[model samples]
Target: MPKGIYNVPEAYNEPVLSYAPGTKEREQVAAAFKEMYNSTVDVPMYIGSEEIRTGKTRDINPPFDHKKSVGKYHEGDVSHVEKAIKSALDARTKWAALSWEHRASIFLKAAELIAGPYRAKINAATMIGQAKTVHQAEIDAACEFIDFLRFNVEFMTQIYAEQPVSSDGIWNRMEYRPLEGFIYAITPFNFTAIAGNLPASPAMMGNVVVWKPSASQMLSANVIMEVFKLAGLPDGVINMVQGNAAEISDTIFDHTDFAGVHYTGSTAVFNGIWGKIGQNINKYKTYPRIVGETGGKDFVLAHPSSIPAQVATALSRGAFEYQGQKCSAASRAYIPKSIWPEVKELLVKAVKSMKMGSTEDMSNFVSAVIHEGSFDKLASYIDAAKKASDAEIVVGGGYDKSKGWFIEPTVIETSNPKYDTMCTELFGPVLTVHVYDDTKWEETLKLVDETSPYALTGAIFSQDRYAIEQATKALENCAGNFYINDKPTGAVVGQQPFGGARASGTNDKAGSVLNLLRWVSPRTIKETFVPPTDYRYPFLG
Candidate 1:
């Protein structure tokens, strides 16, 4: 019983606040960071209308200062995951039946809450829990997440507006119904925005969700749950559970009500879940939707005509920002031999200039990796590169975990184009470079395309129009989000729909209508004005 057509507020990207010196945002975030850092919080699993704290708890430690505990989150077992699934299923009917505008209003309110009251708190949590610099936290936990909520509302309305054309004697319409069962949302720790978005996107489409956030991100994830509760999201609409990933995934995938998964994690993990879903396909009531944005060995390829200074800046920022943990972070670079000396000099200087420490100091451009495991992995890679005959550590081959999991921004120059660092994903503050001959621009593009199993993101820098065009065409299939004269990271929500094909992911393009379409099953309705009583007469004539 809807009374009138409703239009959501005009959606726009939330303005990113510069937490610069002497600014109000700077003071607010610093205060919040200090308060959260000094306090210890206990987080529990959310199922239905209850907060279930299974006394089994794990401490939430900051990567930049591992010995200090900012909080602890209650860990769940298989039973807790099962309860979360049941909660989502039990709540699905009422949630899906709610008016679409109501759903839109809830998310829009969440956006405002994030933009206004919760901005500093969420950003500080990201800084403490995930080790992101203030700028990184601002762009991610604040602006990008706000954009995802507001723009998704607009995208939903657009999807609802799409209808079939009616003939003169008939009427036609389309009804987009939520999937038959619940959604399983698995998010990563690299970006707090992604952690919020993976579940919020599906829930915005009226599908109930069972979300499992990464353990390393519990602090910021708890803030997101708070925002959702304040924004008036109903109980059990999105049940959040944290524990063993395998146990949670197994419990969800084996259920007959398993409808779909929205995942952002390692390529290996995504593939593993896809296999599990395939094995359980026979048990499901409907074919499940699988959407994921996985790992990336993203690249930056420079033409001989490219400016050395610009290319150097791109690599410095793209490879070291957030310690290069981003899925789209530039892990590999192909620089022309003509400009190699200048680019190398500038890049080395930039890396040497960055100060790495805790995010409390706004001047620190780099911070620790997420955990000890990442620190060890990056150290092993740096050690291996040091001994490799064809590779040399150009700069920053040092690491120290005595205080925190800090790895220096390292660069490896390899004579071999297929060196392990160039082809593999390091997912740390490491960049590998291959100096190709300037005349071999086309050949280098081919090499770049063929180098990685991933096709998530890549950037081409060039001053020559013809070279740019040629590189663009040659590298089309290698990057889902291709950038011209820029770094591969920092993709905005509405401006660049992000995802990939091949080993990267399903390329569903999260942030656009294409992604939202995956959550609904449309039914076409056509009513004839004249009954088909004379149907046989037309055939006879």
Candidate 2:
């Protein structure tokens, strides 16, 4: 390869396909959906160059229709985890030693695959697997994941191009080295894009990754592996495993070679991982980097001066889309009294009109939660709201699990600002609205800020610039991803780098250069053109 200064192509956000009527992409995706839905795939754990299949297995079913078998994934145990670790270590040296441009090329090709041929397949898989509708899958699996791959490659090259300032007689250079040991990527079930990006971003920075995707996300996760393989990624660069979280995490965290963990899941699990790493701090050769994105009780606050239609639409799309499973989904809303009546009427109408069913049909905006546990938890919350005097179901509060884990998109209007439903992360299609006095905007803003432990995402809709400015400043520390006159959900990769502070996450801001920086440890190199003959300083003379 020629050694010369290089620059990556200008990164651009991938356009989301509406998948509207009579569109070619819609037809292709619909066809793929039908094919995938009718088929039952067998998924195996990918370790090194081998696809290992364990005797122990479990069926993978779509959340929308549990009776329909999408696939079956082989479950690996501790021994398999060991092999995965060994495989990663064995491959790290050669993989990391390769030139940065080569690494960039592989992921760039992967992005193209996602953007073109695999787009329909991946989106279909996401729709079937995660119960996401066409629009959600289009934005998530197709656009966001593709953005991650292409932009991450560009970001990687940007990182490699950065050099230190050189002094009079010396040339200074900086190298962004991957972590000494392997990285552990623990992804969640919500976003297929996040699942792929978590591991791929680190691996692109010359690191080996042991990725453990959520059990619920196996269908789309397997597709991601296939796409990576097609991109000519080397074997053992990213080892895919699906199994018991506790067993696998314990095994991975216990290993001496463990360098870091890139996690996106719950707060409890994140805390447990941190505690375990702390307990084993003395055992590792180097300090392990922990980059995580966890839970969010994301909110939307509409001011008295805001337009009711726009505010209602924001809540409808932000909360009900994908059944409010996204961490950044608006589960809580703080509306002022002046527009409360109109906002409620419009919101109730919109929510009532939303179609909740299988993702196979593009008409349905809402679908089933991930599984029974989630369904049960959400159902319990809805029941509690119904029984309690402080909370009232304004639009929807229905659930039916006999067919599939389906819960109607429920909105609870609560008088108690500090109600359990208002603060807790339901992680379902449930939005609790807390109405406050128009004069108490500042106080209500404080209530929104202090109500939840999470600071992931929050939005303020206002026609008044002064009110918007105040909300923006007051809620500055409350949400990492804050939106103005927009919903809290749908944070595009480059434009709005996602993550939050406090209980939300480490605020590493995924999809940005900041997140990529966490995967690397920088080292400086200096080359001297002239040497002092006598090791004496001019100050001494």
TM-score of each: 0.99, 0.99
Best by lDDT: 1
Q: Model 2, residue 78: what's the lDDT? A: 94
Worst 10-residue lDDT window, candidate 1: 532-541
Model 2 weakest 10-residue run by lDDT: 1-10
Q: What lDDT tens digits, residue by residue, belong to model 1 across residues 295-322? A: 8999999999899999999999999999
Per-residue lDDT tens digits of candidate 2, residues 1-541?
4697667777788888878899999999999999999989999999999998997899999987898787899999999999999999999999999888788889888999999999999999999999999999999999999899888888887777778788899999998889999999999999999999999999999999999999999999999999999999999999998888899999988888899999999999999999999999998889999998999999999989999999999999898888999999999999988898998899988988888889988898888999999999999999999999999999899999987899999899999999999989989999999999888888998898899999999999999999999999999998999999999998888889999999988999998999999999999889999877898889998
Instruction: State the lDDT at 339 in candidate 2.
Output: 91
Q: For candidate 1, report its TM-score.
A: 0.99
- Against the hidden true structure, what lDDT does model 1 obtain? 0.95
Q: Which parts of model 1 are misplaced by more than 4 Å?
A: none
lDDT of each: 0.95, 0.92
TM-score of 2: 0.99
